[model samples]
Target chain A: MSDAASVQAVRATVGDSEFDRDTAPTRRAPGVYDIDLSAGWTILGAVNGGYLLAVLGRALADALPHGDPFTISAHYLTASKPGPAVVRTDVVRTGRTLSTGQASLFQYDDEGHEVERIRVLASYGDLDTLPDDVRTAAEPPAFPPMEHCFGPEDGPAPAAGTSAIADRLMLKLDPSTLGWALGAPSGKGEMRSWFGLADGRDADPFSLLLAVDALPPTAFEIGLSGWVPTVELTVHVRCRPAPGPLRVSITTRNLAGGFLEEDAEVWDSADRLVAQSRQLARVRLG
Target chain B: MSDAASVQAVRATVGDSEFDRDTAPTRRAPGVYDIDLSAGWTILGAVNGGYLLAVLGRALADALPHGDPFTISAHYLTASKPGPAVVRTDVVRTGRTLSTGQASLFQYDDEGHEVERIRVLASYGDLDTLPDDVRTAAEPPAFPPMEHCFGPEDGPAPAAGTSAIADRLMLKLDPSTLGWALGAPSGKGEMRSWFGLADGRDADPFSLLLAVDALPPTAFEIGLSGWVPTVELTVHVRCRPAPGPLRVSITTRNLAGGFLEEDAEVWDSADRLVAQSRQLARVRLG
Candidate 1:
């Protein structure tokens, strides 16, 4: 096929949202897909873990019969770069209420061998039919209005070649938690932020996957620096998100042995819990 | 082979502790093994999810070169009963720092069909070599002395066949969280307990898997009752536990559409964070 025809084939499967277009997966086989890692989604010269999760999630959602990802757990094996990649999915089980599966993202190396970047196990369900009885003991984090928060353009410019993701994601940090970016650190081990797509796309279940890990590592507030690489991340999509910027809060409860565990909760503009995640990462302190 | 000889072969592989013997997996092939699900570790007539995770963790640990499980995420597909089961492990990646793998627990039906009960993805590492730098912002829950807490024998007798696990694990609950059992729900969505093996085996990295999920569903304190089935659970083993009853606290922050998310933290007797877990379960409030 010609280059134009190939590009058209890929665009045909893309969804309406910018996130959808960027994370769109084109079916290559019965359970395999070809995806493009957008150049704008990198952090510290590597693709963001959460964006990679969404890319894998898109393939898992398409390969299975379900329409929504209920839970996704991914382990990052190696850093991935922008360009073409392959997603191979294996459906582990299909049930009436949920479907379980695994997807591995791979990038070819110099020797033309597939090198795995991430492996994920996820379960997908139809969220529209979920029961709506709400009982919440956790309240959304109180943050200043979006206008008062320090947004992407308001904060000190990130070091060059470090935060390309900021161009794709419009993140507004809680003023109190912004100390780490400056010379002072809060030592509180927590962070709160407003998360949204820079292209004005509303947060959805797939995008919430990105929003959960969108903020800077909570360890930054506790006086840790350098690139914190996520070893494992698990996100549970509780509800469909409302069409507005998400309220995100992350806390680092424990940091030991040069490792830390970060827990994150994302609430929709409607003040409902939409997603929750926990990740294990290495704290690179020089 | 004679029944006596078959039993001897299995006994040869069992470890020193009761937990080890109960969760031991006899290698069946390169990546497959046979495990006997002990009848004593049941809640609501089904095998405890955490116990089952340990069963899988054992197999994954044995299959890999690592000595400890760093993180384990499991998706419970169906109710697992106490009987003979099979564990199949697949190593996804082997790194110097961590080895990633997946394990699936399966049981046979009367018709001889293998049914998968739990699916797990985990990473194994050597905790001994982990850096000793410590920085923690989370503190252990302040409960009265262990003697003052409600031990298994002190609480109202659990319904027959409801909590067989209590017989195998000595769980002491904070008096305040025991209202759910005495006909007065706390409505606080939190539960704190001291966890230890009734058999007197000290908690290790393997058994810490069970300690994380051993607590009752935090939803029980918020006026929900019935067998809460865990849909997904992720446990991160932070550090090796000291030789004593581990302090555990679980809190349910959000419950919507009959679904809830529970976060648990386990601290060693020395007041060091040892393990942390989060689970998504269905709240059966009839």
Candidate 2:
């Protein structure tokens, strides 16, 4: 792709409308964000964590004193919905070589009450080889492709009958990486599928994580009809590894009381752990 | 001990009056809770993720429906401080048995603009045992007892001393079972320790998380002067392990542009991953 087209693609990815947050609608009318459950930007059900992550990327760009590639490493804290939220950020200490910052999130109610919260630590630095001690837990989980696992009859057909966002990418998961438990008898129960985004897009770590995070937890866990708005999704990039068909493994760890939580971890096609994700969802029983 | 004496002792251990916060001249009409940058809360640093975790636990309880146990398992999303922050939560489905939710936190300006956002997922459930396929990656980190770690020389000694709260039925950690990575290089960076509380406190999962989250992050990571107000802290609990001494590790991942971010993880002393944490801070840097 030409440089212009690449730039355009990046723009197009972000240009898409943001999630229409029905619970915490963004209040721009008063030029102040009044976090009320009643109103907020609502991302359609199509919106996934990847989309929000992109939006967050843009927001971070705007927040940084000088726009720099701020790589998110870990998130320590956060809150639940149906309540008020709060966020915090701090600059550790900026040195000539490297700089770091942390941010936290919380949910609140209309009566000026806090509902839930999350915290994140981020660092920006001149890319260099990290200390050898910084290694991932293990290679990615082993699983078949989304097609082999979910099959076409499973759920929505891929956007062009293709596995990844772009056609060329493929996730070559080594089945022996981690022993994976099979899905429930329903065939729709939680399952992990190894995936890889074709080159080009994979270079963008956020995009890779977005795709990893965007995979629906319900698809692997619960067979739900229609969209189950992901109330919240968190992604932690343990270490950025060479991108390819990164292994994306997901499982619905626990589910009850109308709410469910799923666990996900991303590993490179080479089997190195790249990122980790979890989603708390409101499943609509099909 | 007499009943009256027991009550007095308990109060002394978990005493609120021990805090000189109310008397601080810089803090007046302290919006329900005004934490001054100087003389912050004790545990870790007067102001660190632990304090915010304490506050967030209270917020989750307050926001719950009828304040049910609201056992929340949250994932850290992002962190930023000293200004507008955002946290998003997904109200996973609500059901009779268990429920799950997700949240994100962001820091923004007064104009309702997002400064940083942290996204997290949470789960609520009744305490029940599933076929526990429990295994941890590392044992909890070991450290001197809290008394030794935070002893008189560590900082201002808790007025009531260790014996004060010792009698209370709060969770007690057996550091032996916890996984720990002691800070190295003469501790050139942050520090982490693992702990498990005795199963004495309220069994409400949220309450338990709140108490554990209340530990100060600054305490683990050494070398810093003056107080820093915790803009916020978030907590995420995965599967609750047997309440015993759990490993808690903290590291100053990065610092930049007058902002800093820290990463923390909690593990059962046995080394099973309990919960992971991150914090975004705005430091005085004086």
Candidate 3:
């Protein structure tokens, strides 16, 4: 079993449903393995454009269904990488619970090509309601939950061991919505927290994209400064969040000079927007 | 000279270009256009994902530049429509100065079948500066200078006529060494800023993408809340910003339950990281 003991026995039977092992990251053409860029779930030191958009959304939720709810409506970042990077996905169509996909990532020098390319389309609705031409029914946006939020300290740390589904659904956060705070300022230099997954957990979609790729910096509750890390992140999942205290709102629309862009919506506590994310950062001035 | 009299004689010789010729919303293909989602530009009306990402970045700067300093790097949005939406673009390579293209927009439902699909990948670089090793040496983020920021009033009531390259590039707002407050938020959902041109104006890449697609909400400037207009927007330039105040950032990552995604990043104040954009929004809940 050596590929590092089958990558440590497939990272110790990850999120076991009796060990599924696909670790999905496919892509037969267009450069190859567009998703390694130094592996997933890092924080301050960087790596967490939602952990490579939940590893291109766990390869589009391993081809859909188990009560499909996915969300991450759109994303883009054609190119930008000085060091490491990789990502790969492709489904195009799986149908039934709903499927359609495409992902390509690559970055490792001499102008490492294809920075990102996507075309996701997934469906499998449930929390129902809200489609009559959706013109603001208002309601969502209350806040304060998740044991009052507080997580994320500094850079590449999470590689310990967790999985009874990443310890019953990863990336917790709810010290009151991880202490809500983040108007914007996080070009990748780092910080992340608007996280999700707690109570009776059900996260799924790669554990709700590893709980928003392991939160810690909603720019540290809005103090702001400099640092850009998300070289690229794209999410589109439409539903999935049985976990708990997930209210996330964070925003940073644009950041000139250094180059930045941020967006998050994630809601489930009856606010319902469910999934949406976008990122591409590269600012870091210490 | 009839086309609303050449758009009213180019808005009487660009007296503060804010030109608005929109009314033409209804082409399903062949150059394509259809985002009218019922004219909701200001109060975040329902379909304006930054005006369909400035009409797919003015159909990719009318398929590659010529005069202006074309900018825009990222954008994402997969679908959205209240009345109907669609766009189409493709050039991929033009090259006189530099050009490359791709634009795919499809939003239908009058029994047309497909509901949403947008794809974009545009590049037109080559003004020089061919070094790269992922630059951005540092120093940016100051916050305060959108000629004295204030917006949130949700502008839009003025505009008698404009667009001589947006009456010569007017949008403003700068300062984000990572402090976060970018610009173009005079209220009304997702809008953005940091524009150029003006002084002796002479733009082309579709008038610098209609002046950053007429700077305005792509979505989420701190919960201004849903609209999800743009169905597609993709850009990538990297150089050219001769004018001034070229520092912009925009965000609105995902919205799921209502369908959404947004992006923008343009820098040049020495902070480098020139252009990037992504869009694909479908939310409608006004």
Cα lDDT tens digits for candidate 2, A1-286: 9997776466222223122232122433321233332212122312234533433433333344433333453322222332233334455435453344544444556676654343333444433323334311244444665445532224443323432222333333322221222322243335455554333344344554455554534443344444454544545444455744555666653343344555566666555555555555545543
Per-residue alpha-carbon lDDT of model 1 for A184-239, expressed as tens digits?
88998899999988767787788989998889888888988888999999999999
RMSD to the true structure for each prediction, in A, is 5.4, 11.0, 21.4
**Model 3: per-residue lDDT, tens digit, A1-286?**
5575564343233354321222345554542443344322333334444444555555555444423434343333333322345555444434443344544445544475443433233333233443533323234555544444443332222322421233323343444333333333223322334454323333455545445435544444333444445533444455555544565555553344343445555666556565555554444433
Model 1 docking grade: medium
The residue ranges of model 3 lying beyond 4 angstroms of the native Cα positions read A1-11, A14-208, A217-286, B1-19, B22-52, B56-104, B107-286
- lDDT score at residue A43, model 1, on the 0-100 scale: 83
Task: Compute the lDDT of residue A283 as modeled in candidate 3.
Answer: 49
Candidate 1: stretches off by over 4 Å: A1-14, A159-162, B1-14, B159-162
lDDT head-to-head 2 vs 3, winner: 3
Order candidates by DockQ, high to low.
Answer: 1, 2, 3
lDDT of 1 by residue, B92-131 (tens): 9998989999999999999989999999989899999998
TM-score of chain A of each: 0.93, 0.53, 0.29
Q: Which candidate, 2 or 3, has the higher TM-score? A: 2
User: What is chain B's TM-score across the candidates, in the order shown?
Assistant: 0.93, 0.50, 0.29
